[model samples]
Target chain A: MTKIYELMPDIQGEEMLILQNLCRDYSEEKLRNFATIYRTRRKDPLLILVLTLVGLAGFAGIHRILLNQIGMGILYFFTGGLCLIGTIVDAVNYQQLTLQFNRRLAMEVHQLLNREV
Target chain B: MWCLLNTFFACVLRTFSKKTFLSLPCKDFKSDDGMKSGIVRFFVHNFEAWFWLTSLILLAFMPPESTQTTFCVWHLLGFESCLGCGLGHSISSAFHGHWITSFKFHPLGLVAIAILTIRIVSVFNQNYTFERLNKKFTHDKNL
Candidate 1:
């Protein structure tokens, strides 16, 4: 079976280490299941950046909407990205957004998979 | 002399009404308290949907000036140029199918609509996820 590192080659920073340690107890099959679920749930930062660029082209808050930040998404839509300032800010901070979302997804998947069987 | 006397009477009547109005106690309406809480909660919960929905509906129905006049602090302040100056007009134009005009006013109008559409869709996604999670927990508890 593939190691966690092989499954999530792109995982980095604290998440990489945390996920590695958290999944250490799982069997090969359980780890595969976790990997499948996490992969589906996780969002790529690069994808967020791409969506933010789409915001620049026309839609200003698609990235925020994708991140499940409906409040901020609505704000950005109504305010024209707060006169494009907020959109620029989000463009710069998309990586952080991606990290936060992925982290939450990781935890949720972890909890779901670890439920007593 | 008759006109002068009539003017004097009118002045006295105005003054008397003013005095009585000023002397009246200011009453706070009790029902307003309940209404305020409900209004606040409405905004606090799922405010995004309400905001976008309101904007879309208003933009579709009301003329641009009506919505623009109230919310635009920058315009009210007499600023020659502000970041959001043309955005409302742009959105209004887009709603009217004036794509080129809308872009001319503010290029982000279409983007705003797209983002709003996505947000609306995600609300459904959010509810579905919540239900799925709830069911998962209930199933786990049953077992």
Candidate 2:
């Protein structure tokens, strides 16, 4: 009886809780499928943090683009991450941003798996 | 400077990792203080949405023509100009109905506002639908 977190060690506690809640009724096979698809879709918080730090070096907004926020990515790209204030803020809140994106991803995966069955 | 940046990043990562491990999972919902925890969880889950909303409101209220001190870090660090320097002022002017002045302050201010508005809406929409799904699941489980 392996736990959901065990399957995805990169996921934070809050995200694990969300995933567990979503997959409460899933069979083992379905859960594995969900995890496999989700692993490919989810963004790594550490990667986002590094990208945001790159924003400080005059290449800002790559992280936003990675997160599928193209408009914000462009703004950050042109404005130097709102003069680096936005980049600094994004650095501090990288976990939250990643969590939000991952939560959406988990929901999408859940729906997709359920539709398949 | 590189050493300083590395140290800062390391500190941030350490703090975040510590917080992540300490955070409780779904078991918190079954506790005696369900209502309090639910409210706290809502705030924790939707923090980014609230942040953008608060910032937009504050910007909307700020006087467009005030002689405010600059808060740009690049300026403080002795840089002559940064691409984002006049963005806030531009947004403030736009909010106050001065489209020409907003463009004069910064051409991209209006575009930024539109983009931020869209981002805020989409974030809130995602949370709304997800919460509804959670509630439906819980209801079905109880039955």
Can you give the TM-score per candidate against the true fold? 0.46, 0.83
Best candidate, TM-score:
2
Pick out the ten consecutive residues of candidate 1 chain B with the lowest summed lDDT. Answer: B20-29
Give the clashing residue pairs of candidate 1, or none.
A55-A59, A58-B111, A59-B111
Worst 10 residues of 2 chain B by lDDT: B1-10
CAPRI tier for the interface of model 2: acceptable
Model 1 ranges with Cα > 4 A deviation: B1-143
Best by lDDT: 2
| Shift in Å, residue A51, candidate 2 | 0.9
Every model's DockQ:
0.07, 0.46
Chain A TM-score for model 1, please?
Answer: 0.89
RMSD of 1: 18.1
Tens-digit lDDT string for candidate 2 (A34-80) = 88999999899999999999988899999999998999999999889
Q: After superposition on all CA atoms, how large is the RMSD of candidate 2?
A: 5.4
Q: How high is the TM-score of chain A in each model?
A: 0.89, 0.96
Model 2 clash tally, residue pairs: 0
What digit string (tens of lDDT, one per residue) describes model 1 on residues A1-117? 568999878777545654664565678988999889998888888889988877655477788888888767776666656555455545645654575577568768878887845
